[model samples]
Target chain A: MSTLAVAKKEFHDGIRSRVLAGLTVLFGAFMAGAAYYYTEITPPAGIQSSAEPQTIAVINSLIIPTYILLPIIGTILGYKSISGERESGSLKFLLGLPHTRRDVVCGKLLGRSGIITVSVLVGFAVGGLALYALTDAFQIVDFAVLTGVSILLGMVFVSIAIAFSSAVRSSTIATAGAISLVLVFLFFWNVVLTLVGYVAQELSLIETAQSQTPTWLQFFASLNPTGAYQTTSIYLLDNGTRSVPSNPPFYLEEWFGFVILAFWLVVPIGLAYLRFDRTDL
Target chain B: MPAIETIGLTKRYDGVTAVNELDLVVEEGEVFGFLGPNGAGKSTTIDVLLDFTRPTSGTVTVLGEDAQRESQSIRRRTGVLPEGCDLYDRLTGRQHLRFVNESKDADDDPDTMAERVGIPEAIDRKVGGYSKGMKQRLAFGAALVGEPELLILDEPSTGLDPSGAHEMREIVQEESARGATVFFSSHILGQVEAVCDRVGILHDGELVAEDTMEGLRNAMDREAVLTVEVNRVPEDAIAAVRALPGVSGLTTDGTTLSAHCRDGAKAAVINELEAAGASIEDFGLETASLEELFLAYTGDRPSRPIDKPTVAAGIDAAGERTEGHR
Candidate 1:
């Protein structure tokens, strides 16, 4: 009950803050505009229209918003949950309460998760409805799958944010570290893999060139939450969309990507909770 | 059972000891005052009691529970206003009160608490905009929100104006009257003297004196200064007065004679003066005050030693030895 009380208080304060509100409004506007443009402008032109069903266009529209918004919001929200409380001296007041340290950490995570979940659901609903009105087409199954993958991607980023927040003392530093980490996973990791692949090909390391790449690199690429989420999203929209594939075929094998994405979500958050539970603040 | 107890409790930072083997006990419902100068371990002792900081040695028990072992339980029943405490600036005064109330599972009626502390009108204002006195009052209100069984306040009167200080003192008294133990620390001797049932004076991390105000005064056997206007004051009469037990010093200003003697010696001195052919015009006994008593216990000179331990003796014999190299 006390945990719920804490969650409710945090949720109320979070929603009222100009930072969160601004982010929500900006993301809503951008996603709605993008959905409208994609449905109204691209399909009617038939300039390069593929034979894929319109459900594919709808999935692509939703995925575009998820890719652009989830990571930024996740990093911003979770990065300050603990470090900000400590910096503001509220940690002592919270510690003085009857709840255990574990309860505090879990309650904060739950509260932030609640906020992210609401924002994503609302954004997805509005964007999906706009796309449906503009294109006059929708696929419930693809939409559900896309929403699930987007939420999973958001959780992975949130977990990473929490992990870094617990390790840093200042809120600004924590937020920077979380953002840097997400950028590394999303952008830098792919660059490194591409370099490795080019170097391996030049050397002609083995007869089976595709198989010559290190298993660890493959594992890391698969563990990239953005890449995994993108792959899973594309597979779910296979019959409906003609959007560009976010990850190569080698990165999307079987259920490997989902298992790896789930690992990314659980492990970092679990470690973050452990670190938080033992910290003095 | 005692409401709070510490045995050999010590806290050390690096090589310096903040509180060294401190042993203290406050009886249940006692308004006990912990007195000390600026750096006398009073706040450290309170921190150990509240489990905000861990002690390096010994033990602390509050309300029959070991403070460190059962800190949560202790916290559940204890309300503390820590020294140099800071509150959430973004929260309104009422919000702060409600937060504390919800945390303690107590009733959340911020208006009543605010009214009691005389801040109801500004309850909706952010604490950041509050004056120092107002902040102190809000902190006090938070501590009293749950009405816990034991209230541990470290210099709770800091930043409070005279009226606010008086109101806080009254609240402390009220809390004690309702069967709650109130342990407060203060550098101001008069405030403690006004309400404390007993006080323990700490000088340089050690408990030098512990007794009620009257008990302490009596223990010191303080002297009363008596001024007498007399006719024909004789040298022999002055000598005779000095010769009496408890009479130590005498001075005469023309027809006026001032005599200093142990508290109960004024009457004997007067009787001796009258018999010695000195006609007395007026006489009065001045009782020792808390200030004088405090100085006597904390600021005595060791060169001229009395039979009992005076403040100077305590300072030199204990304070010096304990404070060496610290």
Candidate 2:
């Protein structure tokens, strides 16, 4: 009950923030624009003139926007979860009540996740409604799956940001951590993996084709949350229209992308809570 | 059971002791003032009581529950206004009060609490727009919500004007009158003197003095300044006054003689002067104030030559309740 009360307070407090309101507007605008481009722009430009391709095409087109927007939203929402409270000195005021440290961590996760979940749903609704009006054969199942998985993707990043917030003593360190995370997940992750792939090829350690990286390397690179979201969304919505091969080693199968995303959502925060619970606030 | 008890409680950050092997007990149904100068470890001791920080080695029991083990249970029954802390910026005063009430499973109307704290007008406003005093009043109201058995208010008068401080004291009196044990810490002497039944002085991470209103005065052994005005300056009368037990530093100007004597020794000095045949004209008696008593105990004296109570007088120290305590 105390945990829920805290969560409720956090949600109430965060929603009033101008930063969140601004992010919501920006996210909504991008979602609506991306939906127009998918429905009207691409069909006349000589791709998928049937008013719809396989469900994966529409889902894939929407992915890049969500992929970029959700991380920014999640990181912005959660980077200061614990450390900001500590800095403002409210953590003491909070702990003065009947809450244990576990209550605080759990409450922050639930409340921030609530914010992202609501924002994602609102954005998806705006985009999905436009796409429905524009296309005759739009698949609602694929849309729902994409919406649900997008929320999960946002939650994974939120969890990681909060984990960083809890472990660091100051918000500056947490901000530094959040930025580093964005760099690694959004840009640097694939570069590092491709570099590794090229070096392996040069050394004759593994046979690799220009069209596809080794299966193990592809699976390893997909462990990044954004990569995992893409892999999972594509494979789940795949209706066999693209020329890309689908077969791979068992562990490298597309379903494991969900496992990778779940791993990200659970592991970092689970580890962070151990330190947060033991250390003095 | 004691409202708060700490046995050999010690807390250290790095090598510097924040609270030394301190033993303290606050009984039920009394307003206890925790007094200290800055960096005196008063807040450190309070943090330990709330389990916000663990002690290096000791046992603390709040309402007879082990502080670390039963912290949530202890907090559920105790209301606290933490010092050097900030309120939520985006939350309105009403929302803050409601959060407290819901967290404690207590039903307290926000409007009534706002009225009680004298902040009814501002309760609906966000705390970001509140003055420090308004925030203090709201925090005070939040602490009152559950009618907690124990109220631990650290520096309750901080950021409050004199009128607000006075009103806060009245609320303390009302809480005490309703049978709640109120333990508050403050560096301001007069405010604590006004409401606390007993006061404990902490200095340099040590419990230097603990006693009731009268007991603290007596325990400090602060001198009473006795001024005797006489018709004529009698040489032997001055000598006789000097010889009185507990009297020291006798001085005179014209027909007036001033002497400093221990609390109860002022009368004896005057009697000795009269016995020596000096005609009484006019005189003045000024007993040590609570502020002076506070300074005497917490002030720097030469580190206790040999009678260091922690060693020689382990069982009998200044803060130990000798009389009118417990």
Which one wins on lDDT? 2
lDDT, each prediction:
0.73, 0.83
What would the per-residue lDDT of candidate 2 be over residues A45-110, giving only the tens digit for each residue? 424555456344665678888999999899988899899988887888899999998898888888
In model 1, where do residues sit more than 4 Å from their true spots?
Answer: A41-53, A167-173, A191-212, A235-266, A272-281, B13-16, B37-44, B89-91, B125-129, B187-191, B201-209, B213-326
lDDT of 1 by residue, B99-211 (tens): 77887889958999999988999999988789978887888888887889998888888998788889999999999999999999998887788889999988778887889
What does DockQ come to for candidate 1?
0.23
> Residue-wise lDDT of candidate 2 within B1-326, one digit each (tens)?
99999999999999999999999999999999999887899999999999889889999999999999999999999999999568988999999999999999999899999999999999889999999999999999998989999999999999999999999999999999999999999987898988889988899999877889878666434665556666787768878877888874466667777665675676677667767776666555555456655655665322112222222122133223222122
Model 1 chain B: ten consecutive residues of lowest lDDT: B301-310
- What value does the lDDT take at residue A178 in candidate 1? 91
| Candidate 2 chain B, run of 10 with poorest lDDT | B303-312
Q: Considering summed lDDT, which 10 consecutive residues are worst modelled in model 1 chain A?
A: A43-52
Docking class of 1: incorrect
Q: Could you estimate the TM-score for every candidate? A: 0.73, 0.83
